[model samples]
Target: MTDDSSRAFVPGHVTGFFSVHEADDPEQAGSRGAGLTLSEGVTVEVEPAVETSMQLNDEPAAIEAVTRVLGDLGVEARVTATTDLPIGAGFGVSGAAALGTALAANRTFDCGRSENELVTIAHTAEVEAGTGLGDVVAQARGGVPIRLDPGAPEYGRMDGVPARSRVEYLTLGERSTEEVLAGNTDRLSEVGVDMLVRLVEKPTLPTLLASSRKFAREADLLTPGVEDVLEDVADEGGEAAMAMLGETIFALGNGLTRAGYDAEACEVHPTGATLEMD
Candidate 1:
């Protein structure tokens, strides 16, 4: 019998990073950051087949993640992935796709791996590929997740906002996360650590957005386009912030349309990844 499984996960946007620390184990090394998972995300399908293959949503990191998971599980299958959000737009598409693939593949192969175990697999894949840092962990827990500690689910500590809020985002363009992360992060890390501490102390959506905006300016990550959009969004009485590692702007309200930008609206997803079998 061929087993088929499908899973859904939320996309996350990082507010800032505290530090990029290396652990005794490579998988445990990551950045402490604050992020939130939106309702929109990627869905993955896994089915037993003669050969193992992956069809990702134009994310090369997903190829490494799927291949690694299938190799570890000793299962051969065809993996298909799709997403509602743009890849590399700081929406955690790569992390979501990896996490969804891991969940669905575990069920499809009847591996009986725990959620934490699956999360670790996905996190390791993302880290190894340099595609993401805390996104997998944040997407795993959903909501406005704060990465108190870095690493996979087992080593990382996650907290979040208890309430859901409307989220609107406009994509200006894409940025290379690997390129950004590889640059000297001394200044960025300092500001990020401070912002993360403040956000954890309060843990609210407004505080998150405000802190994100501050981080963007302090870290010098903002572009002229993003600045223009933010100015227009403010004029329309909305609070907006740039998505980490991307040129996209995530706003708190629906005033983006009035600013001449098309906004995609969603709610803060309250839960983590989910799976289905057929």
Candidate 2:
């Protein structure tokens, strides 16, 4: 810990495609998908305090995922999370904050929890909060994660695309995930399952983006701006797709720039969430 406070970083994840699976148990509820872990994300700082408090981007807030972790650990602390990615824009900012909180709190209070335990805690917290499904697990593993099974880290299974490259994204606006998940998702799941199967067979970047575009079309979650940007990127010989549950589109490498859009770019994070060393 640094000066009685701890800090952690969690890469933001962009799920290309996913099929949700709910259960009575939060730990057993999650989604199966594949996505890239961007280097830009949320960084959380934790300090033991008399009463628990939280601030997001310098504003007072009660983030449910952060609160859930503190409550589950039976500790009172002040949490401050600053997000590099757009909030509620499918960059997995909430999940990043949740995972970062777990990592920082574990060090701040000396909870002595293992990596998997912390991940499970964050995953369960996200599911319980209705903010996300597989993002916590993807942020925990980094890279291009292929979620083969649905659940928390301990119960779920994942694989990777085994490669890395740049990612470009542009967020037109924020979108709430709860409404999307609460609505009927049978068709979404069906298309997602098929795309996942195809990805599992190929496990390449081209296949991932191709399958993701198909999934997004089948799920009917693309905005006009997103669709236009995708077409432009493809015309420039680059692959792109809409980020699930958000009006954001991400392209492989320099796709967005080549398409003449001013986009935020970053590489796929090589590592997952961890305590930031002083």
Candidate 3:
């Protein structure tokens, strides 16, 4: 009924992603020029408290965003979780956190917002935070996401990479989402929007992802190493592409085999994030 309600929840997560159509430079990505859905299967925990106190890193913006959404719903709860990843590494960390909080807080108050509604709220928070152009949508709706228009911020679900595809990911490092978004507005344009629309309508999901990856490389967002890695993987009988921003890259194609990639090279993750009540 209110923030005082005693309940909790945790949700699942996956690293779904929305592709970027052009090159992102320092002037655009602010040092972290790509976007992605970070760690998936994130676990969120909630507990009933006299008042709502969200415990997380210094993401007051996220706290504020969730609080505002919860306030609108007249529900509240104690929110806490693992040290959240950077805001923008192209991972849906922001959406995961928001959705996790919403799921947790929903139980705390016995509120009944549907998953769709919660996702909508999370998207609003992401917009308010300005960490992503469409990470919320991809995170919320999983799978390969294709945003036809960055202006209206509209997108739709895309099929996963083909089952027979051979690919793996490589982690580069970490970067803050906020820092990456700091100077990216100039790169956002109608042309990028059109490119996304075309990709989404591609005959196959794999084709769509491959094309988008090429576009990213042509735009110069994909570093030499990143491009080299992709080329190596693809030439080695696999297709490799940047995952989210730069923190990681995933290889895709018919010839890729799990054995082809070094398990020790990078951590494998479920495709989405999750939350739960303890």
Going through the candidates in the order shown, the clash numbers are 0, 0, 39
lDDT per residue as tens, model 3, 1-278: 23343322222222223333322221121111112232333445556666767755533334555565566567655666554343344445555666666666666666787766665666566555554445544555444434433321223333333222223445566655456445553443333444455555653545555654755655445666666666666676565566544455665433224425452222223243343323
lDDT of each: 0.78, 0.91, 0.47
- Model 3 per-residue lDDT at 79: 63
Model 1, runs deviating above 4 Å:
1-3, 6-18, 57-62
Could you give candidate 1's per-residue lDDT for residues 1-278 as a string of tens digits? 23355454445554433456556674797788776688888777778889877776744333666677677677887777777787778888777777887888788777999989988988888787777787888888877888888999778888877777787888888999889888898888888889988888888877887888888899899899998998998888787888887888887757677677878988778887777535
Ranking by TM-score: 2, 1, 3
Off by over 4 Å in 2: none
Tell me how far the alpha carbon of residue 99 in candidate 3 is from the true structure, in angstroms, after superposition: 1.3
**Which window of ten consecutive residues has the lowest lDDT sum in model 3?**
25-34
Candidate 1 clash pair list: none
Top-scoring candidate (TM-score)? 2
